[model samples]
Target chain A: MTLRGKAAIVSYGETPVTRARKDKGEPRLSYWEYFAWATSLALKKAGMTTKDLDGQGLAVMHPEVDHSLFLGVEVAEMLGVTSKWIITPSHGGASGCVGLAQAALAVSSGIVDRVLCVIGDAPMTYGDTMMLTEHRRDFEKPFGVMGPTSLFALVMRRHMEQYGTKVEHTGKIAVTQREHAVLNPDAVFKERFTMEDYLNSRMIAEPIRLLDTVMRVNGGSAFIVTKTEEAKRWTDKPVYLLGYGECNNYHHGSKALSDATLMGIGQASREALSMAGLEPRDMNFFQPYDDFTIAVLMQIEAAGFCEVGKGGKFIEETDLSYRGSIPLNTGGGQISAGQPGLAGGNLNLVEGVRQLRGEGEGRQIQGAKAGMVTGIGAVQYGRNVGYNSVAVLGSEL
Target chain B: MSRFGVKEGGEARKPLPYITNYSQGFWEGTKAGELRIQKCNACSHKQWIPKAACEECGSIDLSWIKSGGKGKVYSYSIIRHVVMNSMAFEKEIPYALALIDLDDGVRVVGQVVECKPEDVKIGMEVEAFFEDIGGASIFKFRPRR
Candidate 1:
């Protein structure tokens, strides 16, 4: 009943992160163009073409003018190909990873042989992000609580209060990720920063500083997934999805939700690892969504890399650099690499694939055979992320 | 439903709480200088904001019940930068917004006033107060003295 290794990710492609604007005379890309480039690059990397894709899915987390009524169909049409199944996932930041899971299901279940999982967002280039975020939220807008920064800040403060997690511990995450980013030429932020720089960074929301937040950028990433039998034809090393799990609205505003530091990632991660027949120790690396430094800290605890309420100590003792044990966000993550809207999930997901495929050059986790990529996003503004997904990937069975 | 767009003068007034028919009951209670929570009569389940059905049970027999307007600070964040309308919240530059765990067991978000931003702490006792702004009764919390 398990889809363990039934489907393999044959290739991954990502465009350089950019804030290019037509106004600044820099070349810019819409989500449409980004999707095209991302998917085509993935196919070309596998020595295949659009003709090989029998399933199509797009991850468009935020509203964009380029989005159509029928997203999957439009994506296929744009690629000038026909697909057996078309999928569009709306899991916020988890959208692209959810799309990958759906693509995996379609391929593993024999509904489709090869599926193209594409994700792109041009919020910076198009400026449609503010239009979508500002107008709605009858419940959210009035309180002067802006966006994720404000919302997550409460969670960060709660963590510090309840668990004694401190700025010194959380700031390490940004410092380590920036170090990894310095080695990644495609990373948006090239310069490395230290704990001192992190502390000195301007505070947007108390406890959540300028460095703790993910920078929004425009970019695209894609993966080509196929049944293992067909996957070998495309690449010598096909990264296999061993397991995955998702949960939403856990303990929603119930008495239990009063604890702002709580997250559903614990349940999701347990299910994924159990399905993979692996433990957290088996992962060669970890790459959870880093919309904020606190997010990565919370995931580290929820994913069982450390004990709950002990993330501070775990972070203090652990080496998070790319060359260190338990390598994390080797490609700089969304915090260091500019988050491309909800495509932020894809940035981590694709990085996991590239590392598994041994494609990570300068920032590669050496001898990395397996890793976990997690997706977390704001399903609602009230209490942390609503949807959390975990994917366990490996280079072999 | 109350008007949602920018008020006639635009940003001169504080933003109004988003009021829909589903949540009109809660707003009405707030306007009457009371804090009410949605309670499922069948399951005795308590909820916040407003929803059509009981979150715990499928009961539609939901009614507005008065809350003690007292809660403990579940969490709080000091907003140093303004992301909403500057005209509305700019002067208030750094303020403490909190998620309050109501004594009734439901959680809600409101700004914590009458205290320094740094003084806001988890488990701090607070009580709800209404702010009359732009003809809307906005619920905010202050240190319960």
Candidate 2:
């Protein structure tokens, strides 16, 4: 009934992160191509081929793409693999972790032996801006409630009012993550930024500056999940899925429930940690989704890293750098590394897996045995994220 | 000037929500200067933004009821820069967007007009006001004085 310790991620892969491809001169891949490239890399690393995959899960790339073929069926046909179980998750930023959790269930339930979960997107290629406004196209767009920046701005402002959180606290996250990005060769923005620079950045939405938001870029990431008993046959360094949880408290455009300060990540985190038989302190590192710095702060509080309304203080007093006390987003998160459309959530999930596998070359947390990754999705009423997913991963079973 | 030149008679080009059958009542109510929200008869739960069935008790028996339209500002944001490239809102550099928890217990999102962006704050009392833009009734909020 529970996926805990039953499935393991044997290998993971990612295409190079890039801003855009103006022409063939650049080494940018298409949305589908990025998925293929990452899948091939993961399969190779797992010492297997597409033929070995009996289950597949993919995240829908963009809304403009033709859904007549259905992403799930298209991917299976393109990969030349016949999957008995297939799904195309569309939970926005939470799709990656949601897909991974679903795949874990599929493999653990004896429905499939090997499951491949992938998410990728070329936002620059598709000209995809924050698409959450599409939820209520007419109602939100006319009023200029356009993107995630404004939505998160509202959340940040509310947080400030209730908790006395200031820009300095969030600036700390941006500054610290920039520092982490310097050590990550794959990071899009490797240049370090100071708190002053973050504070001085142009405001995209009031209470949310440019530095606090994630950059839209082109990339894809993937991982292979299999039964824990069969994981040893693929790789020696397998990261087991300790536990996972997902929650969608409200549907898009629904205003029945409104709590800007609470992103519903607490429920998901609590469920995951309880299932994993772990506590917040048990995490050697954290990879909370970082579409915005405020999101990370809220998740930290919701996940019980600190008490509610104390996230700002926690950020101020805690060290989030790679070698710091609480290693966070060691790969610079989506803020510095660039968000690849719906694949943004994978940026956190994959980084957690890599750290647990001892693969973080420069930003490795010493003796990291477990890590927590989180994802947020679907802005409610074009204001706040309403869905959350969290997973606990461990290096040892 | 209409709040940062965002609206000018009928020349403002902005995206508008298409009036569908399920939402026609809400739109019509706005045009008539009345705030309407769906109420589930089974559990008496109020809903906003118009949906097919009751979100609370999963009942399709719902009725459109007039709302008091008076509530406190639950949260708010000020748009310093426009994310969407709409000509109508391009010049609206700073506008207050607010979430209001209606007296009927349903939250609604609307722009806060007739006030400076900085004047908006959480817990501030507000009331819904309908604005007619090019034949479309768009609901907005204003600080209750």
Question: Across residues A68-163, which tens digit of lDDT does each residue of candidate 2 receive?
Answer: 347777777788877888877777788778878888888788887778888667767766444334346766776667466777887788889989
Clashing pairs in 2: A138-B16, A138-B17
List ranges where model 2 is wrong by over 4 Å: A21-24, A54-69, A128-135, A250-257, B1-12
> Model 2, A275: alpha-carbon shift in Å?
1.2
DockQ scores of the candidates: 0.54, 0.57
Model 1 C-alpha lDDT per residue in residues A1-397, reported as the tens digit of each score: 7878888989888887787866778677788888888877888899987766644433334333346667667777788887767777767777766877888888778777877788777878765453334223555656667667888888889889888999999899999999888888888898988799899999999989999998888888888888888888999999998988888776634543445677888898998999999999999999998899999999999999999899999999999887777888988999888888767778988889989888889888888998899988673445767889999999998
Q: What is the C-alpha RMSD of each candidate to the true structure, in Å?
A: 2.8, 3.6
Interface RMSD computed for candidate 1 is what?
Answer: 2.4
Model 2: docking quality category: medium
